[model samples]
Target: MTHRPRSSARRGDHSHGDVHLHGHGHAHGHDHPGHSHPTGVRGVLHGIFVPHSHDAADSIDDAMEAHSQGIRAVKVSLVLMLVTTVVQAVIVAFSGSVALLADTVHNLSDALTAVPLWIAFVLSRRVATRRYTYGFNRAEDLAGLFIVLMIALSAVVAAVEAIDRMVSPRPMENIGWVIAAGVVGFLGNEAVAVYRIRVGRRIGSAALVADGIHARTDGFTSLAVVAGGIGVLLGFPLADPIVGLLISAMIAVLLVGTVRSVGRRLMDGVEPELVDRAERALGEVIGIDSVDRVRMRWIGHRLHGDALVRTSATTLVDADRLASTAEETVRQRLPNLDEIAVRVVAVGS
Candidate 1:
């Protein structure tokens, strides 16, 4: 006998020796093994410098709720980044600091990146249609590609401006205001980074996580603007353009990781660890003989997959029960799991 279970509901149908089950229920547990924060001094440093991708403190089990949270995070971060960019722009005009100008340009791009992400999150909520069976979830990945282009464009613009300033060697004015603007930029970008990364990890949104990492890099580059201002204060006029060039270089280097991450999703590549976890969950089910195969992918921030399991259950009733248990086990193991199809086949058949 073979059994296939459906998601979003639980009912059973029997025909011949085959069984089909479907229905919906809530999962109460949120225990994810090997996804805990580090301890000791390393933990503190990691917390300060590198944010974890998963945090149990705010994990949302509901898909719709996760989408709502993602939109809210984008909205708030967008406002903060816009304010920071405006403040930096005013300072750049008064101080003529190429470094500040570079940072401001990148920040503006970062803020605008939120618009597409917000649209994506909203589009992901639509029901699947006949023409687009997977719904609009892939819009999120497309938004990620747009973000990559924006980052690249900002890098090119910054590099060109820095080179021009280096050639002309203009004397920077109001060094103190430039330093103050740098401080403002760092604070704003860092705050947005922390918020976006936290929410992105909580919801498993790779696009949002990439944006957050971008913001974090921008924060560090803003500090470089401060360094340039101090150098100018000490009478090194070339330092401003030099720091601008370095910022452009940093952005170009950082673009590689974001591209790889978004590309992996577009190619349907998932972390091996997620597959391993699904397999383990299936194997642990009471009536399952073995986990034959597991395949998973990210659609927007949610996980959806299918698995094949072998079972000794020879009758339709036993197979249906086994399939339901196996599916539930996998769901409990993985947070933000939107859907999973479990197929059970009789062993030695």
Candidate 2:
């Protein structure tokens, strides 16, 4: 049998009475687990440099709130990045720093990437229609693919500019302005990176997280521009083109992780730990004999899945009770779960 609960709110408390069974169906809930930190120096460095994206402790329980939070993060970061790009562009005009120009171009593209994500967030808020049964949540994933393309485009542009500069060297003027602009770019991108990543992780948005990583890398690339400027000051004209080339390579390297993350989601790949957690939750149900199967996928920032369990309950009423309990238990275990189907099969059947 299936147990599905309906509610207007994202994470309202529901009792067994609230769940109505109509054959094999599903239920919905919005809650998440807490976060835990690892120990040792390695763990500390990892935490500081690469914070975990799916920390349950910071997750938003309300679906609407999560969307709102994602939109806010995108808007704020977009403005910050644009301002940084404009500042760097002004410096690039008179300074003739190829490295700064490359960084500025990438920053501009990064800022534009947020537009598609913002549209996706808005589309995701649409209710599921008969034709679009699953709603527009997949728009977020599509936006993620667009982000990857933008990153690739930026890398290509930076590499080409650097190569041309290397072949025909140009003396950079306003060395101090280029250095100051690099510092400004670094500060701006870093701030946006931190804000985007924090909100994205809390909202379970892979697209936002990817964008944040892009910005973080951009910040470092900006620092490379400063190094290039200093090298030019120290009588090394090749440093500017070289650093620009390095920035391009760095962008290409970082693109791999973002591609893997977004591609995995499109393929419906979920963390193995989440499956293990679901199995353990089902096994904990008092009357369940065994967990037959559990499958989960990401539908935007929320999770949806189904579980099959063999139960010892003989009567229909008993089996229904067991199924309800199992569903509830799974929801509690996976707070980010948007919907879950708990199917109970008789031990012999």
Q: Candidate 2's residue-wise lDDT over 136-183, tens digit each?
A: 788988898888887787678768877998999888777898789889
Pick out the ten consecutive residues of candidate 2 with the lowest summed lDDT.
14-23
lDDT on C-alpha atoms for all candidate structures: 0.73, 0.75
Mark the regions of model 1 whose C-alpha exceeds 4 Å error after superposition. Answer: 1-50, 53-57, 89-106
In candidate 2, which residue ranges exceed 4 Å CA deviation?
A: 1-5, 11-49, 53-56, 89-106
Residue 36 lDDT in candidate 1: 41
Model 1, 217-318: lDDT tens per residue? 677667877888898888898887799798787677667666777888888877676788788877888987787778778877777677767777767777
Best candidate according to lDDT:
2
